[model samples]
Target: MAGYLTTHVLDTARGCPAAGLKIMLYKLSGNSHRKLLEVVTNDDGRTNAPILPAESFETGSYELVFCAGDYLRATGQAGDDPLFLDEIPIRFGMSDAEAHYHVPLLLSPFSYGTYRGS
Candidate 1:
């Protein structure tokens, strides 16, 4: 089972796929962090391709930064004041290189949740 990384974002407030949300993937080692890739969600609220393609997938710590605040503002859902949820960074570890990693985010203007998916 070769490994890969994928993500999906759902706009809880609008009850639809979080289209146009920005996502950034980072590879973290010790105190050093390196940006891997950046992508935007499609009409299905998912990347056109995996965040980390199979060939580039590795067993290590990684981070996915979701720009929730900007999405909300662009969609005309956020208030003018400070946002409760901004760039939502989900840090996770890949212990097995041969496993599929699906990180899905359930998001709203004021709150968000994420979990490991199939």
Candidate 2:
């Protein structure tokens, strides 16, 4: 078995999956970040496939940028011009080469939370 990365977003304000949210994956090295890929959440708030599949899995620092502003605006949760929470970036490191990593975001217009899930 090999390691891979997965993620999802939930709209806590609406109590539903954050469909149509855009997410970007980046691998960080020192002061630079190399974009890996960009994906959109489906109706289930999940990507159609793993963000980092085993074929290209790596053990290092990575970031997941969730386009929370767009989702908030689309869902009419954003109240003003400047949203309290916009693009949410979560940075983490993968240590095990043969492990599965699941990162999920729980978001609202004013706040957000994340965790490493199974």
Candidate 3:
């Protein structure tokens, strides 16, 4: 069996879908080639679809890079100090082939969070 990776971005500061944020996914190095997963997000702060397709899934670490700078810049949220962490990475293992992974992020101008979700 194979699994898929899903994610959603909620801007706690803005209280809306981080509509224009850019993001990237990388499969950690392992037996697999470990290449950059296709980067995509939607108007609702979620990916148009899952990051990993169900058929090509496997066990390994993955990193999600959220373009916080881009999001703030576009939204006029970036401050003069740039205290907000721009590149937020969530690294996790897809250890269970039968289970789906959902990585959800709630971010603000100064902070953010991420974890292995349903």
Candidate 4:
């Protein structure tokens, strides 16, 4: 079964799992982003666990920053001038405290996509 805020990083450029990628989950505050959680992608390109636990659900705006540039660089799949996305920030709103919110990201060097999931 999948958990809330589950994400997978697929290096579309190489069609491989983006392991060791650091990701930070943040909630939008008044003027700055409040960090909710931080984790690195595992071998399967997934987090070790859901960023949001069962007892930690809350209503707020969230952002997920994917360190794609570093991930690609470490994997030796980056060019000197590779346009790695420094930060891929996805802004979303959570209104249901009891409902689960899953955010998945499919990323490439040149582009990326995000969507709400179960």
In Å, residue 68's CA in model 3 sits off its true spot by: 0.7
lDDT of 1 by residue, 1-118 (tens): 6899999999988999999999999999999989999999999999999999998999999999999989999999988768878899999999988899999999988789989999
lDDT accuracy of residue 100 in candidate 3: 92
**Clashing residue pairs in candidate 1, if any?**
none
What are the per-residue Cα lDDT tens digits for candidate 3 across 3-111? 8888889989979988767778888786553556656468898888787879767768888888887788778888886555788877778888888999998989899
Q: Rank the candidates by lDDT, best first.
A: 2, 1, 3, 4
| Top candidate when judged by lDDT against the true structure | 2
**Per-residue lDDT of 23-109 in model 2, one digit per residue for the tens?**
999999999999999999999999999999999999999999999999999999999988898899999999999999999999999
Better of 1 and 4 by TM-score: 1
Model 4, residue 113: C-alpha shift (Å): 0.9
Per-candidate clash tally: 0, 0, 0, 0
Regarding lDDT, does 3 or 4 come out ahead?
3
**Residue lDDT tens for model 4, 20-114:** 99999998977889898899999988898878776676677888888888887787766677455767888888877667677777877678887
- After superposition, candidate 4 runs with Cα above 4 Å error: 1-3, 82-84
CA RMSD for every model? 0.7, 0.5, 2.3, 2.6
Lowest-lDDT window of 10 residues in candidate 3? 31-40
Preferred candidate (TM-score higher): 1 or 2:
2
